[model samples]
Target: MDILDQLGAVREGKLSRRKFTKGLLAAGVAMTTVPLPARRAMASEGEQATYFTWGGYDIPELFGPYQEQNGTLPNFAIFGGSEEALTKMRGGFVVDVSHPCNQSMPRWVQTGLFQPIDTARVANWGDVIPELVDLPGNGAEAGKVWMAPFDWGQTSITYRTDLVELEGEESWDILWDPRYAGRLGSLASGGDAWWCGAIKAGIDFANIDTPEAFDKIAAVMREQRPLMRLYTDDTTTLEQALSAGEMVASMTWNSSAVLLQAEGIPVKFARPKEGALTWVCGVMIHKDAPNLDRAYDVIDSLLSVETGHFMINDWGYGHSNSKAFDQFEEETLAGLGLSKNPVEILNAGHFQQPQTQEWETQMNELFEQIKAGF
Candidate 1:
């Protein structure tokens, strides 16, 4: 069965381990062998702490207030990839918090790099959505929140609706359509590209371990690459391409679509048939994080409803705080694709976990091969 059908079964209470195992295995999940991180604490606040996160995530607008409250500002560093974050952490970067996705949580935990969170210290902890706060691997009691969800969004097909009208809606298969040869855009990075490729290959992305599955993904991407105008990591470029009619559609973050729509770009962010490749960025405290208390203050600040509003309205990503939705007008909610009932969206969304180093290595190697025209 296809991914959508499998999701349907899951939603209907019919998806079972027997049916989902191969897909899970392909996704490289070894249930029995799941690794957890070791516990350790870095020096206290007298020493400085560095934070490694996405570029925008640590902006002064976001962290300044926390600094004012905590009396110490965290030194910041930026990374484009989770692999880069992991690499630095392993190499003794004393980050107070490292923004990693849920998928990367397991790998970081297994590496003994994280200092578990003290939920009690975070006053707004109760405000976080229950499922989101207490997901399968969060390990709240162990003082390691693994990662705290800061923002969430779907990976969808961003297309100029004025340019093309499909019968039903945009689907992942469109990326593979020969009809649109030489007119597509794709990500040059590993995570987004692999997730996008897996969906188009018709192998459940959650199950991608087999050589056949990897080959299936590679074959489709090879075909799509010829059609792609260029593989890029910058969303700014994707937006420019769409606006100039250089490319009509591309896979991109929901925020990009929201921004374009606000500018009257006539873009449609379609939730593909295979389900959107959903991702959430979280704050993972480094095991040796200095200024531990201050780091907690930063986490609390980010979790505040006020911050959530800024994240949702200004940043264009869904906040981890459920309360943030209450602030949005009904029409506004619909425009951001948050109008769908929460449960429905969550059930349909494909959450990514941090991949193991082995998988990361394979992905990097495979991605390189694809880029080199192999």
Candidate 2:
């Protein structure tokens, strides 16, 4: 069968994931042998904007309105991490829009690669959470917004309710509990894992760069190492492990719990007594974006209540648009462990703050060493 047929079979469960991947590899090799113009022509099919973002976000569900209006999904370029995306952009890779979180907004603004977004162009501007839009460095001047906040959520322990028992109110300390040692997982990115460690260590994130805080956080992470089964940023991998009962618990995003619950996996996303690590992520227009108008359309679509409903109801994240919360009932919000007002949920957690480049580098390096059991 052809690549499309093979892909269909994979989706329909007629083909194993291994075989489908092999088919894709073979198809990619065959495509490389095609003429350059043919390859370029193939890539140009209904392409409106080029979206640079994390892997899972390239899906059509987040931009349904854009697809319906434009008759195509934006071309996507996936990045494993924000730093990788920035490095590529600096290396001259041009994309109409890029996604980054509040913590990285300051650094991204300093790069001067993004321009201020005209909120007047975004139809859903007034409906968006003001706190998210007013994130540090998200605006160049009074009233000129930069990024259009799209998604907000927490990173916390997701445990198998059937396999694990709580000794007290849910907390980050569970990852260090010896009872589940060797059955736990964590995100590989220090950007996330390090902050979670700080929460567990009782370190103030605003003062996280201090020697005392660094040392204390490092100790907490080192203690967690031996207890972990793996360290990875791939949410699918962690969710699969949880589904197969291979892992009792792991550090994961809100989406993991949503996905697992849909599949009838007995998972619970912890609301740690110390507080969860929360973040607001959004899209920014590249300074030299070729499809500027299309970029605005994409942002507006993302901010729509339709997209917001998908983000909250399907992905277990808080949509930036306040009107999105109106679609759900109080009981449903409570079941998902979310608040009707995004600000209340954001305030309840240890919201991530911008960190200095030096501090980020140091924390990443230290976390890497600890993960290596050093």
Candidate 3:
């Protein structure tokens, strides 16, 4: 079935593998990242600075403060993956702010498509985790960072506990397994997949730029290509497939597992023995943001404590705001694969390291070819 039909089944509670008392929309369904209706009355698209982000993040829950202050939610533009969003921006698509993970932060900055975010404007700036904001190419000047760290989480294996049998301690090798070959799914973006490929190849993130590391990663990715059943960035599509038992496991973010678990799916967001791919994604204002003041408000809203709780509990990501953890009990946080102390999770995983523009070009190019069975 097509993506829409799959999600339609999910929303209508028609997926037959198991019964989901709560539909996929419970976590606010992930859409195509196109122009989405705001939860509240939406102002004209031209009136407010647009928020360019991933599909699920465009929902109204995260925009509570932004809508309260502006009388309406800002224009929402979504992209299936970060690479596509960056490509569009590089091709003269100017947006008020865009979401990008730390893996692409340096390259996005090098494109000259963004400006440093003045931390003074973000009211919750001081509450953001220090390690998250301290990224490479984070602007030389203090208080002005290239990206305001918003949601951070791990990119790892989310597998079916009932459908698949484990061989030993969980590892990235699950995605490369020959037994689950045709039943595997994955995200199509290089940002997460390529880095995870490096991990699976036993390459160090700190030394991933070397020629040897690149070749080893490429060899492993090529080996796994033939085994994948679907490689799309759409969350609902993959999640529905998992719900229906069409695929056994997928390379997914923390949010996917949280949403799936809520749907009553017997899934585990595996903490692979090799290590999970940890990342921090946030907003960067366009150099010429149309509504510059409102753009700051958009960033501020995303960084707010209220949004932090939603991101952590509902979306299953580690929010930048430390205070957001106060509302949740330690036991609850552990269940979501998060902690009150952000560093505990961030440091335990393979935190991403930024690369130069050239490395990005090479990785993207090579990955595209590999995905195409080249």
Candidate 4:
């Protein structure tokens, strides 16, 4: 069966969990695999900006204004994780605009691969939520914005509510609970899992660079290693596993829960007592963009309320534009666990911060060793 049919069968309970997972593997869905939506070719006839971004963002719904103006979508390339995207750019894969979260902006800036954005050129700059725009390292001292903050979301525990039981308040400790060992999963990206691990270990995110804090977080992750049935950056695979009953719980973004619920899966995105891991991600212009004007157009279109509507309504993420929240009712926003007040949501969780390159290198290497059972 094709992917959509397989998804339908899993959602309708027509396919067993094990069979569903096997089907996905047979269909070539695995770790670090970008979704099929991102594999399409760039428009050959137009002078378009090359956009490097995550899978779902490549869809035309997010760039309607640009398409309406140019009559074609931007040239799209995708990465499963931020570190991989950065590595490619560092190795000279030039793209007009690339997406990276707040945590990685410092390193991206350090690489000298991106130039500051001229906010005047972006039509929606004035409408963007300030908290997202003013993130550390996002703007230079002279007030040149480095990234155009467009999307915000959370990384939290997404569990099969029908299968997982809670003792008290929900917490990250559930991932380490012996009862669920061998049925748990996590994202393979250290950018996410490591920060989540720090929260679970009771280490302050700001102090994660300290040796004492590092040791504590390392211990928690090492304990979690054997318990995980799989570690992948593929959100589709993670959602499929949860839907199939192959995984009772996994560390995932808000989009996973949204997607599963739409498919009739009994999943819940936990607002852990320790707080969820929240983030803001946006687009930055390449230092040597071939299509600079089109690149600005792409950023402006993405930050528009039309794209914001698609982001919140379709993908369950918060848009950086204040006008976007105006489109939703209070009850609807609350149900989706979002608010027009970005500060409330941002303060409700452990917001990721930019880490030093040395610390990031050490953390990723250690996490990989642990995952490999070394």
Which scores higher on lDDT, 1 or 2? 2
Please give the range of 10 consecutive residues that has the lowest summed lDDT in model 3. 13-22
Whichever of 1 and 4 has more TM-score, that candidate is 4
lDDT of each: 0.69, 0.81, 0.83, 0.85
Whole-model lDDT, model 1: 0.69
lDDT of 3 at 189: 88
Q: How would you order the candidates by TM-score, starting with the best?
A: 4, 3, 2, 1
Clashes by residue pair, model 3: 33-78
lDDT of candidate 1 over 68-137, digit per residue (tens): 6755445667787788778877887777777887667777788888878877788778878766766657
For model 3, the stretches where C-alpha displacement exceeds 4 angstroms are: 1-41
Model 3, span 57-107: residue lDDT tens: 666568779878887667878897777898898888888999998888888
Stretches off by above 4 angstroms in model 1 are 1-49, 67-74, 140-144, 165-167, 179-182, 339-342, 353-355
RMSD of each: 14.8, 5.9, 5.1, 5.4
Worst 10 residues of 2 by lDDT: 34-43
- Taking all chains together, the TM-score of candidate 1 against the true structure is 0.80
lDDT of 4 by residue, 60-166 (tens): 67878998888777888889888889889889899999999999998999999989898888888889999988898776756788889999989999999999999
* Candidate maximizing lDDT: 4
